[model samples]
Target chain A: MLNQLARDVKASMSIYDAGDDKVYGLLAEFAHPGELLHAAEAVREAGFRHFDTHSPFPIHGMDKAMGLGNSIVGWITLGGGITGLSLATLMQWWMGAVDYPINISGKPFFAVEPSIPIMFELTVLLASLATAAGMFALNGLPRPYNPLFYSKNFARVTDDAFFLHIAASDTKFDRDATAQMLEKLGASNVETIHDHGVEDQD
Target chain B: MSTASTDKTLAHLADFHDEAPLVKGNLTFHDITEIVSSHTEKKTPFAWYGAFSLALAGLMLLVGMIAYLFWNGTGVWGLNNPVGWGYAIVNFVFWVGIGHAGTLISAILFLFRQQWRTAINRSAEAMTIFAVICALVFPTIHVGRVWAIYWTLPLPNQMNMWPQFKSPLLWDVFAVSTYFTVSLVFWYIGLVPDLASMRDRAKGKLRKLVLGVASMGWTGANRHWRNYEKAYLLLAALATPLVLSVHSVVSFDFAVSIVPGWHTTIFPPYFVAGAIFSGFAMVVTLLVIARKIYGVENIITVDHLEKMNIIILLTGTMVGFAYITEFFIAWYSGVQYEQYAFVNRMFGPYAWAYWTMMSCNLFFPQFFWFKKLRRNITFMFIISIFVNIGMWFERFVITVTSLHRDYLPSSWDYYTPTAVDVLTFVGTFGLFFTLFLLFLRFMPMVAVAEVKGIMPEADPHFYDHEGDGHHAEHAVEPSTQQ
Candidate 1:
């Protein structure tokens, strides 16, 4: 039953492919951030989930307009920090109390006061590392390949231009209709991007 | 209030650039990218060669000093029985304190939404990493057996022994190492977007390949940005506490001891404040020369320099208060050893060092109270150098003076740095500048993506709603596009 569902989704996705090549998505460019933001709102209102806006920097309120929930990176970092604190406490206690205990100034073996600094340092260390790692993992970074790279117009997205791309994998994606809707919404350039099988070429 | 007066107040508040532009020049997005990237992409300037040569020579000297110290042992230096922690400890604390300004500017100011940091954060973060490198040299070599430095870590071995967790020295190891790791990651994560920009613009095959790998395929995808922003915020939050703790741990090294002058309740806050004061002074010294050499006068403006001087003033005052409070506390306690330590610091053999610290840190920054002097480039430059020198002396007086005249009069002797001691301290500068010059030559000195974000033209609502003249050329007419 799962295989059938997967096949059905693939069939629907192929309908937007147009058979010339495996197109990645439709790329739409806006002259200003307001237009791009509005277009993102329109795309979300139209029930497209697998779409994103590209700009030189993050636009305030753009995430809300795009219907993106708050990121989970913070929660992951918190978890990492707690784990670090517990690990540091346990390791120090085990070393001092159980492993090879020796008397130092007749103090208690598992004193909490002196261990606080190491625990604090470890917590921060692990939290920061987890934040970086989680961000990269979520972003699917270091892939070094994307269909967007083939679009000459999309390069400006890191400069002055703002863009919104609707992936063909979206359930409602129809290439011609998406292009028209983007143009109607004041996109300056609406270009259909092909996958071009660059990954295979490499 | 009258409506006319209310309107006037609002108008005044809206004039964000009534003074001068934070980033000077009518800069387009392309212009910002080109201007910053040119420093890396263009031919290596002759001026850079001269500076790098001097730095390289210093680096060689540092190498020689380290080799000699390692071969002959710590005895070659002026570390007698009483003054065991002499120049090495002083230089270590000095360099470590110098590293705080970078994290404070990049992480703390960023969290505060200080947009001006974008113009200088890149270079400042690089300085933090290099300064920490220079700082690490002292602790490593001070171990006497440099090859056995790993024993400081809590590692399991055949001997079945562990580091003393209760010791402040062990805490220092963990704190400093963690601080270094977090600062490095924060610096690199911040560099990703700019690295991607460089990768996109690179024409040479080698340059493109190198930057492409370094950027890790950052396409500025909005999904990636969502995670990136979240991670950046988290790192900044984590670093804020880490910065405070790292310096506090360094202070604990002295404060936890029973030594009369070192055992003080105010040491943590005082050390942290002095760290920030010295760090800012170093930033100002480097930035003044950098802006002049790189011709980035417009981006790193006098306004930025004035703001930095104001910070120096605030922290410097805090340090001065700490100094006075220490004396007052010693007198109030009525402890002879503590009283003597304070008096000896001012009038004893190391009186010169104490006065130098006072004049440099407390007196020199008083000039910044005058806005004209703060804004004057040459005056600010001279004052910043003085502050740097003063901060070093502050550390020297703290570490050496306290040790030179301990509880026992029989053991007490006047401490002096040998030629090797002076050479080693100067060599660390060589290491710092060599790394810093390489960073300046190859890396983007200003964060390009962040600067573009602050431009009014980048905002869609800015052109349509605002009446500001700064972005007049780029503001699109609503009718034409609509």
Candidate 2:
């Protein structure tokens, strides 16, 4: 099968090549998690920055390996909570104590203790709303379409498979060389997956 | 990858052939029905439905009782003067107190990270809403003027009136309503996914329409779960403090007063603790019967009941502590009226009521120290009913005993329930059972999905070898926020 594919590739490209003409990139096989770690580290060490991982389940320490850190969600929550507290306090006080302080129990208008419960409730309400809004913004949800969906086999990722892909658009491109590198690093069944709908970038 | 392939190869035969492979690796949409309904496929025990129908008929009696009370003035009940609140308030507080366990089980136990709570929390949450429903009824009618009750609200009208904002009664309106709304949203949101599962499982039109609308457009996508989780966490966080505040505000109704026994600083914590004590006990009572009737005993294990018993014991102790502290404080404060109120509570005309309150709330729950009794179904049920009795008497003693003999004795009146009070109280129980029986028949009665999620087998990704049991420290994620 490899010899036939090699012959066809050489004929289609119309470049050089005769016997033993080899294709690049071709994912050889899936990697063990440990092997994937090693390969990812090698990719980083070799100064290749663009790559992606697909796994049926999330792996521990994946974020650190991907160099992701720190969500800004906390700041949004804090700010929203502060705003809520202020708004609740102001609204209650203005309406209940400040504006129409018709003496009912002969207590002072701005009785702080009675107000505490409402204050606590508003603070939490606002903080939670902020968190939900911030989460939506950060996740970039409701996108309707994602580039990852272009892969027909990618749907299996949520089931029983694990995968890793390196794109042709990478600066370290030499399709044959990259495929050879991936195969040497222990991918299970190296194959070049074409993303047909990708833009015709010059 | 090599390690995983080798691992898969080692267990491939077992994975395909074994009835229990220690994990169910992947489940598509089709897998859900098989997972839930396989055991349920045969004709259901028609006896369960038959029993439920009988209970529903009993519930209709409660509805009839309520209708009688509403049409007639509150006079149809025995309530007059001193015992105006009588069984109605008792039932109100009783039902409200019972509701605490539901939200507590859902939110507090969840925050505490108790995985065992998953089996019962969903039903307990439903109980919370229904209990609140029973609770709200007493307050609405107890005023003796149901329609004119809106006069309490602050609205501009021809009469030029506004609710006394300083009144604890007014605060109760906000507190109870807020708690109800929050619990409802929480319970409904929790039900959505389960309802969707029910929708998927439905075969006939009845199941399809009911579940489909109830599910609120859930699609079971992973992202939906991710978002729902975050929202649920936030709700749990919000509910925790709200739970604390609700009972405290309710307590303020008595605490803020200058009336002898009614006025005390300890009321807030005391009431909160008692609410939880009674609530947990109620959950045990309900879950025990529910598990037996539903044939779901394995899902609700002895461990779950034992854990709830511990809560009942702890909260019972706290309630006991509050009682002692209030007594000591009354004596120490040396205020003559307050002192009289304390002494009168024990030896006054209503002393039988006082003793009944003490023994029921404080005395019986102590038996939980013996683990055998806590797990013993009959004894726990009896004690739970006793707690209900004691809690009612406690309210009775506080309201009547304290007020009957005021600073001016001539103005004091001995309160007693008319036949009206007795019937009204019975009707409230009718109302409570009516709602509960309906819930059991219609709803899942247990959170099937949550239970499945908590099962160790659901987490196949955690292990490579079948039944490796290496996850000794996963620690069940400790039942975190509901």
Candidate achieving the largest DockQ: 1
**lDDT (CA) for every model shown?**
0.85, 0.64
User: Model 1, which residues run further than 4 Å from truth?
Assistant: A1-20, A198-202, B1-21, B465-482
Which tens-of-lDDT digit does each residue in B1-482 have in candidate 1?
12333333334334343334356776667777778888899899998999999999999999999999999999889988888899998998999999999999999998988878889888889999999999999999999999989888888887888888888999999999999999999999999988888887788999989998999887777777888899999999999999999999999999999888999989999999999999999999999999998888878888898999999999999999999999999999999999999999999999999999999999989999999999999999999999999999998999999999989999999888999999999999999999999999999898888887765555555533354423234444322221
Cα lDDT of candidate 2 equals 0.64
Give the worst 10-residue stretch by lDDT in candidate 2 chain B.
B473-482
What is candidate 2's lDDT per residue for B319-387, written digit by digit as tens?
A: 887888989999999999999988988888888998898898888999999999988988888888888
What TM-score does chain B alone reach in each candidate, compared with the true chain B?
Answer: 0.94, 0.85
When superposed on Cα atoms, how far off is each prediction in RMSD? 4.6, 10.9
Off by over 4 Å in 2: A1-88, A121-202, B1-67, B70-72, B82-84, B151-164, B465-482
